[model samples]
Target: MRLVLVRHGQTDANVRRELDSVPPGAPLNELGLAQADAAGERLATHPVTSVHASRATRAQQTAAPIAAAHGLDVTVHDGVHEVFVGDLEGRSDREAREHFDTVYAAWWTGDLDAHLPGGESAHDLRARYLPVVERITDGVHGDVVLVSHGAAIRLAAAALLGDTAETLYVPNTGLVVLVADPAAPSGWALDHWDSAVPVPGDVTAGGTPR
Candidate 1:
């Protein structure tokens, strides 16, 4: 199976560098909508059989255009949501950097056990997210696209690649493609990690990276 993990378009929280995991709301801003549309146009060439997104509005909005083009409804999965920031949710970057020193340090260093103030730990995020990924892989018979948060997608890529979390910090709207062969021990191989704004092209337009 080919799994394409895509980070959602930028949100107000992203622009302001705040942590936001509020559910069913926080819709995309104008720039975010444009980004989503661009992403969707690029994805239109792929043989995507399924589209999945976090229940968060940002993710849903990101996936909507693709789903509409493909005539598929996005399957909302709660497990794919961004890590809960809890008390730190609405804080400005400067505020968080000042008050949540330990958490910020841990995040910068990719410590999975590090917990945000009153929020979920990176370990906690992996525990929930990995299983959902497994389920998605198991159920889908072909290529799949998953629209999710920046942190969640980064951590998920880390888990899948058997790398440190620090090794997988993807930018907003980043795309990571992985090919999984259920018969192999490791089962999955990283195909590419591309961040260039995807342009309209034939499915075979881009070459695989070495």
Candidate 2:
């Protein structure tokens, strides 16, 4: 089974580069809607069995088309939303961005415990995020698609594929594919990371890393 984690399409908040991490967060803008449709088209070729989305409006909206194309109903799941940004909930200022970048970069450096001013740390994200991934992908016979936020996907993917798999950027509607590795201890392996350079793993896992 492959765990196909996807970032939801663009939003006004995304355009502003703001940290909109809460539930019912920004809806997909017009371009985002188009992107979602395009994503649906792109992923339609995959052998997807289940479609799931975070609590955010944008994620669910992004998921609708994919589910429709697959003849599947998207199952909404809790505890799978974006990493909470408590005090930094809606700021895009230089200071806020700098602070977030510092903390997030630390996560890549193995400091998962680093916390946001009043938000969640990379550790916090894994605690609430991975179980949901486990649950959604548990005993699945085919691929699973999860529409979620960029930062959350990056953090959790690193944890899932091991600490060495960290990389930046999860473009809107881009995918992070983790194929099940029943032979490996983690039960998953990095198959591809869409659009990110210096791709992790063997880079031979196939299926369009671009």
Candidate 3:
């Protein structure tokens, strides 16, 4: 099985550096639509068999063009949703850094048990996300595209890719390709991390992927 992990396009909250993690999340901005289109075009040769995305509006929108390219419908997966921020939801980045320092630090440190007071722990995220990833990789024979959020993708990459995760930074609409390897402990092998799109120029200037 081959997997393509894509980060959702930019959102309004992304430009503002605000934390938007709840349902529906934020809608894509103008550039985000273009980015999604470019991403679909980039995957033209992949022969994607299925397209999946988080329930968030941003992720769903990002998945649309890619799914259309393959004549596939975008399947919304709750397991791939963004990490819930709890009290930090809708708050500015500056505020979150100052108030949620411990939780944020723990996440960067790869502590599976770390989380904000009302949010999900790293272990919680894995329990929900990894199973979905494994199920798809195990069941699918052809390539599959999974459009998910920034932090969630980061966590999963860290756990699945190990050393390679250090350089696997997921930019907005950026792509990561992985292939199944039974001999690997993680049951997958990193083919590429944060692969570039064939788009001529950068689609995101002020916004970040989420």
Say which candidate scores most in TM-score.
2
Candidate 3 local lDDT, 1-65, one digit each (tens)? 78899988877677676767787888889988988999899987787999999989999999999
Q: Relative to the true structure, how large is the alpha-carbon lDDT of every model?
A: 0.71, 0.81, 0.76
Clashes of each: 0, 0, 0
Model 2: CA > 4 A from native: 196-210
Error of 3 at 80 (Å): 0.8
Rank the candidate models, highest TM-score first. 2, 3, 1
User: For candidate 2, what is the total of clashing residue pairs?
Assistant: 0
Report how far off residue 26 is in candidate 2 (Å): 0.4
Candidate 3 has a TM-score of 0.87
Clashes of 1: 0
Q: Compute each candidate's TM-score over C-alphas.
A: 0.83, 0.91, 0.87
Error of 2 at 88 (Å): 0.9
Best candidate (score: lDDT)? 2
Stretches of model 3 off by over 4 angstroms after superposition: 100-102, 162-167, 195-209
Predicted candidate 1: what Cα RMSD to the true structure?
7.0
